[model samples]
Target: MSLKSLGAKIFAKIVFNRIQKWATNPVETQQKVFEKLISEAKNTVLGKDHDFENITSFEDFAAKVPIRDYEELKPYVERVVSGEENILWPGKPLYFAKTSGTTSGAKYIPLTKESMPHHIEAARNAILCYIKETGKADFVDGKMIFLQGSPEMQEKNGIKVGRLSGIVAHYVPAYLQKNRLPSWETNCIEDWETKVDAIVEETKNENMSVISGIPSWVQMYFERLQKSSGKKVGDLFKNFNLFIYGGVNFEPYRAKFENLIGRKVDSIELFPASEGFFAFQDSQKEKGMLLLLNSGIFYEFVEATTFFDKNPKRLTIGEVEIGVNYVMIISTNAGLWAYNLGDTVQFTSTKPYRVIVSGRIKHFISAFGEHVIGKEVEEAMNKAISKFNFSITEFTVAPQITPSEENLPYHEWLVEFDNSPENLQKIAEFLDLEMQQQNSYYFDLIEGKVLQPLKITSLKKDSFQEFMKSEGKLGGQNKVPRLSNDRKIAVALIQIQPQN
Candidate 1:
């Protein structure tokens, strides 16, 4: 084995030991983490303002600090953006990760020198934990390509600003750089399509063993590689075994990915955001991801069913129960206190603190009191795809609140297909039925004549591409909303060259 592989295995063993200790008693681990994080930041401007010095417990912290979103925290973020030192963190931030906003305008999230290690360490531990669990280290000896956004950064008030992928690019360790593909120069290409082509040319014949990126962009790269090599991805790189993906769920695209690769490979899911790296798939034996208890972020959960209540019950890690959907909140080393990150998840296992992403707080359809979320939509789509043997390149669903004066309001799916199904109507009917099976409220609405059967608007080829391009959101961590509460996006989608 190579020296690097041996060192990596040694590191994995050490990290796995720590993971075992942390997972032994999640409640205690989280309590200690919260105390440490709070004590470290209690002297910062935000901490001082919130009386963190006097806060003695989780309940005290929650009572002192109100749950806030980006808008509520905009003033502090703006201060940091304008070169204010020690406003949020101890000093000027190392960088700011610009979030691609759909509803609110783009947000600039601080990444401190202290917090940067959390992102790096969590990522390292994710891979290392996987190796320790599966007893595989050969993948580390070969090249791994990260299909990420442009690493090129811009300065804002002398503080660097870019996407999270760009920041991560700047921090790739020297040892791994030798086995990483696609030169740094190529990674700087601003246009995604052009950059993807460059990446295909650069890594087509390399000894690639692992590939990581958001599923959709990586799929584009794979397609280009297949056309150029005239071979399936598995044939092109027999060693390619691990796929690390985040930013979106991979289930809907799993079949298509396997079809392109000509085989199934081990994959790991990550719950990472601009705010923090929250969790990762730790064991193939378990169903959901294991939350990182010792990471620099302290977590809280507010029941999603009562998220908007004036005084919603806030629960700590000790209080969380399996099967309850919760809106995740965090107080991190980056000076965010009780900040709501807008993602929702449900605990599948509380003993070791494992969870599955349920949906985003903003991405839900409830036009007729039958609320449906991303998880339900993804499951229904996966079922339809599996049974129908079709492929979806991209899709989004929105409530058709006013179908017509005579027609009852219903859901409309705007889908872009790589391989169109034999009968689009049948697929649509199947999805509708699947959704009904998932949500009884939706089923009742349909049966009570309050809602019409779901409708399908098979989008013209490249319709999503045109829409994203027109909006200047065509690439780099931007994704179409899987579900929306209103028809604003759906109406605009229909105008984007509908096939029908």
Candidate 2:
């Protein structure tokens, strides 16, 4: 083994030894973490404003600090951006993760010096933990292509500001830099379409052993590389063995990915957002990600069903139950206190505090009161894919209201196919049937003629990618919403569809 690979294996062994016990007793681990975070932040301006000194326990903390969204926290964040020190954390944050805000225009999430290591550590522990469980570490010896956002950071009030991926790219450890692909100059290109081409050219002939990115973007890169090299991914990169993805559900795109790779490789899912890196798939044996309880963040959950209510019940890790969706509430060392990140997740295991991201609390389609969500759409899509044996490259759903007396209201689907079954109508029917099975309200609407069966708009290939490119949202953690109550996204998709 080369020195770098040998070093990686040794470090992985150390991380595994450190995090193994914490995963077994996550609840206890989180409690201590929560108390420590409070103590760390209790002297800051935000803590002083909220009287954090008097808060002694989780219940006390919850009672003192009201749950806040971006709008509510904007003032404090702005102050930090304007060079205020000790306003949130002990000092000004090192950087801000500017997110593509669906609800608010663009949100700047703080990343303090104290919390930066947590972000790095959580990601490192994920890979290390996976290596420990699977005993696969030689991939570290070959090149790893990390498809990330542009590294061209912008300055705001003397602090660096950029996408979380871009910011994290700067911190990739020096030891692994030798085997990393796509030179830094190429990564600094702001335009994704341009950047992807540069990435493809730089790494096409390299011995890539690991690849990581959001699935859809990675799929695009895979297609480009395959087309250019005229080889399946497995053929192009013989040593490729690990795939790490996050930012969207991977199930709907799994079949397409498997087809492109031409072989099965180990995969890991992570739950990293601009807010924080919360969890990662620790073992191939389990479906859920082991929550990072010892990280510099404290987590709480409110039953998603009751999330909009005034003063909903906030449950700690110890109180969360399996199978119930909960809106995540987080207190982080990055200076956010009891902030609602708007993500909904369901616990799969309470003992180790493992969870599966269900959907976004803001991203649901209830235009006609049927209350369809991302999870339901994903389930229906999964079922249809299983029943029909077809593959989807990308898809999004929106409500199409009746245009007057002539047209009928229906659900509109804009789907880009990697491999389509011959009978499009049969596939559409199966999808509608699965939606009805998953949601009775939707079934009742269709049965009562309140809504027509979902209309399938088969997009010509590359339409989705073009749409994102045109919208300047083409790469790195950006995702097409799975369900929207309005036809804005659907109309845009159609407008950008490739002309036959």
Give the per-residue lDDT of model 1 (tens digit) for 1-500.
Answer: 87777888899999989888988888888888888878887877888998889999998998899999988988888899999887777888889999865558879999888788878888778899888888888999889998877888899999999999889988888888898878999999988888889999999898899999888778888989999999999999999999998888898889879988999999988888889889999987898899988888889999988999999999988899898889999988887889999999999997788999999988899888887999899989998888988887788999887767778988998888886766999998999999999999999999999988898888777777677778887767877788999887787888877344
TM-score of each model, in listed order: 0.96, 0.95
Looking at model 1, the pairs that clash are none
Give candidate 2's error at residue 142 in angstroms.
0.6
**What lDDT does model 1 reach?**
0.87
Each model's lDDT comes to 0.87, 0.87
Residue 331, candidate 1: C-alpha displacement in angstroms: 0.5
Q: Once superposed on the true structure, which residue ranges of model 1 sit more than 4 Å away at CA?
A: 102-104, 498-500
